[model samples]
Target: MSLKGKVALVTGSSRGIGKVIALKLAEEGAKLVINYPVADEAESAQQVVEEIEDLGAEAIALQADVTAMEEVKGMVKEVKQEFDTIDILVNNAGITRDTLLLRMKEEDWDAVLDVNLKGAFNVTKAISRIMMKQRSGRIINISSVVGLMGNAGQSNYAASKAGLIGFTKSVAKELAPRGVTANAIAPGFIETAMTDQLSDKVVEQMLSVIPANSFGQPEDVADTALFLASEGAKYITGEVIRVDGGMTM
Candidate 1:
């Protein structure tokens, strides 16, 4: 196992892309800290923990709103107490409030920014301290292709993701000397509940832009994350790897 005995913390990992990332890390023998935002998601989070345990890997699910600094700090403290070290931190907690700028409400912008951007800020701020002390860590932020190539109805989402890229670069510079690498994965449209809701026509339209002629699976992103979290990528940092299947090419 490439990550045997390592401890990995992936925020908002109860389901979706975050869930897949956590599972992949666990498969590599990394102990998992699966974080969800609220009580309602506890069952789902526990299921992920159970799944990891079934895979013969240790895991615990912690609930913390990534946007809340105090909660984030507490989660970090708890994680340290349990695992003694956090080798990988995946800031995958995010939300989208899509609307054209003219139709966007203040609350919509605030909500998206708080979760997608501020949430990363809060979690990274708290965890980076530990990584700096250890003199080694991997910080992977989940960005989006929309951030690189603007989308008509996703101004807030695009801004948050773009800001995340900038934030990753800055953190990479600050932590490089400590052997910590910070990178962002800008995923294009992946098959998820969000995409499942689209009509066939809409799906075809989306596929048309993707030269691969297909939507990416969550595993594609998860695999990339696994590589980034491994020793193989120790020398790579401050970069954004686009898993867009040529959608933005």
Candidate 2:
């Protein structure tokens, strides 16, 4: 297994892309720390943990709101107690408050920025310290193609994701010397709970523009993430890989 004996903490991994990432990493033999913001959703987190255990790997679910610094700290503390160190950190917790600029509320903007951008900052800050000490780690931030190409009615979401790209680059530069790598995955139109809300006509319109002529799956993003976290990608950092199937090209 490529990740045998490694520990990975994936934030907001209760479902969707995050869940897939966690499972994929576990399949590669990484011990898993699954985090969820919603305390009531322990069952969702537990399901992932059970699956990992069934694969003969260790797993644990942690409840922490990534937007809350205190909660992030607590989550890190729990992971440290169980695993001692984190080799991979996936900042996958994000939320979108989509609306046109004219109708977007201050709260909407703040909420999106806080959860999508600041949440990554908080969790990465907490975990990078241990990684820097170990002199090795992989940090992958989940971004979106909309952050690169921009999209109507999603100004706040786009800004938060774009901000992640800049933040990922800066963090990568700062941590490179310590053997820590930070990168971003900008997914185009991945078929997830987020995209399920779009009508079939809307999806058809999107597919017309995408060269691949299909929506990306969560596993597609997870596969890219697994490669980035592997030794093969050790030298790669501060890069935003578009898993958009040529849509951004």
Candidate 3:
């Protein structure tokens, strides 16, 4: 997985799984661009840049709301100026608005769909142009098992993620002739801050359905992203690789 000289852009990479993915790519010698949505997250994003620098790799922090096309385009411009080209793109910016269908508000539905689905659209549209011209690139979208099997009280989130899968496949086909491959990673119950807040009973219930009988770590998903971005996955495209401990199977 030696990615020396490769440039990777990871959205929503200030923290959580996205952050881990950014670090993992940097570890493999890829230059990184850490993206955060708002000013409030700038500190975290810069911290990620510092972490990458500490790993002896190059990185910079950029701010852009993925749902906004102009902002996404501006960010891509900056990335091109800094790195000249982008070899990898990770659409990991997503949000959840969990509520039952009957109680789900219009704003909640729109917000989730805009960030999870529309954001991927905005970023991919902007970065893929560079990849297409270069005749090579890797695109990885972070989806979820909920998008596959569905989950209670999360219709909007599930819909956004499922839509991402369709978008990924379409992008893959559209860009494959140009040597660009697009795929999605559907992660299961990964142990993050949100999972930490769950009650013992809730955690136990969640683990009961997993063949591993334990929660997955952020590294599990990051490792999968690393593989998808590497030359080893060059022949793979328009596929959904599950990092869920056999939960969907």
Candidate 3 segments whose C-alpha is farther than 4 A from its true place: 197-200
Q: Which digits, one per residue and each the tens of the lDDT, describe model 3 over residues 1-249?
A: 899999999999999999999999999999999999999999999999999999999999999999999999999999989989999999998887777999999999999999999999999999998999999999999999989988988999999999999999999999999999999999999998656765798778889999988889999999999999998999999999999899889
Per-residue lDDT value at 192 in model 2: 89
Error of 1 at 220 (Å): 0.2
RMSD of 3: 1.0
Per-residue accuracy of model 1 over 1-249 as CA lDDT, tens digit each: 489999999999999999999999999899999999999999999999999999999999999999899999999999999999899999998887767899999999999999999999999999998999999999999999988987888899999999999999999999999999999999999998756766798788889999998889999999999999999999999999999899997
lDDT of 3: 0.94
1-249, model 2: which lDDT tens digit per residue?
489999999999989999999999999999999999987889999999999999999999999999999999999999999998899999999887778899999999999999999999999999999999999999999999988978998999999999999999999999999999999999999998999888788888999999988889999999999999999999999999999999989
Model 2, stretches more than 4 Å misplaced? none
Q: Return the TM-score for each candidate structure.
A: 0.98, 0.98, 0.98
Candidates' C-alpha lDDT: 0.94, 0.95, 0.94
Best by TM-score: 2
Error of 2 at 1 (Å): 6.0
Query: What does the lDDT read for residue 240 in candidate 3?
Result: 98
Clashing pairs in 3: none
User: So what's the TM-score on candidate 1?
Assistant: 0.98
